[model samples]
Target: MTAVIYKSKYGSTKRYAEWLAEALGADLLVRESVRAERLRQYDTLIYGGGIYAGGIAGISLLKNCFPAAEGQRLAVFAVGAAPETPESRKALLSKNFTPAMAEAPLFMLRGAMDFGKMTLKDRMMMNLMKKMLDKKPEEEREEWEKNLMSLWGRASDWCDPANLQPILNWAEN
Candidate 1:
């Protein structure tokens, strides 16, 4: 038995979760609805969440309840605006997961960005980031900053089912 759980802020993560759950014939559960006792029943647990400020939304579910699922297979997928490169993935895992939890396989998926739907704080942060990027020469900006600049004032959807393949393979095996 496998459970696919997610915490999505603006839908990208939820979309991926839906695709994954359907593909795996697993239980689809929201992060908020998960309980430690319930988690013990699953032979495998796959958690997905959107990246926000160097954190995975609703990741507390795993950090707080994983003991009950000890010895069970665990995997995590993170959806974010950043490109999925080895460096980015390693950085995200290091910043977000605890030492023990970091041992699990992690999959990174590109996500959508909709400024209009973002919270005021997120908007403000973006504004600040924009100002900083503006100060940097084009050649000096990193790939992520360049991508962010391109996404300004527009919504971009990079959520595709193909990105879930690696996770599916891991879960199935």
Candidate 2:
């Protein structure tokens, strides 16, 4: 049995989790509802979380419960606003996972970003980011910075069910 668990702040991660669960005929669960001890019940565990502050939100649950899933197949997907690139994926993998999780395949999926949906704190942080980016010359800004600047204060949806195909393939295998 496979289970797809996710932590979504603004619905994009949950959207992907729902698609994956439906496609794989796996159980769909929110991260908060899962118990660590029950993680051993699933033969395959798929976790998805929105990326915040360069870390996967609610990932501590997986890290803590991983020991119980020692022999299980594990995979993780991170949803973020940035476009998928090899360098971005590598950076996320390095920042988010420990050496012990090396066996788990990590998938990167682009998510939506809506300033209107953001919380007060989130909005403030984005504004601060915008200020920082404004200070940097356009030529000096990196690719990620440039991309984020383009979407600043704008609403964009990059979530596509097609993005879940790689995960579906992995789950089937």
- Candidate No. with top TM-score: 2
Question: In candidate 2, what are the lDDT values of residues 97-132, reduced to their tens digit?
Answer: 777777899999999999999999999988999999
**Model 2 quality (TM-score):** 0.95
| Top-lDDT structure, candidate number | 2
Q: Predict model 1's lDDT versus the native.
A: 0.88
All candidates: TM-score = 0.94, 0.95
Per-residue alpha-carbon lDDT of candidate 1 for residues 1-173, written as tens digits (9 for 90 to 100): 99999999899999999999999999999988877788899999999999887788888888877656557988999999888777787777888787668678888899999899999999999899899999999999888889889889898889999999999889878
- For each candidate, the alpha-carbon lDDT, in order, equals 0.88, 0.90
Give the local distance difference test score of model 2.
0.90
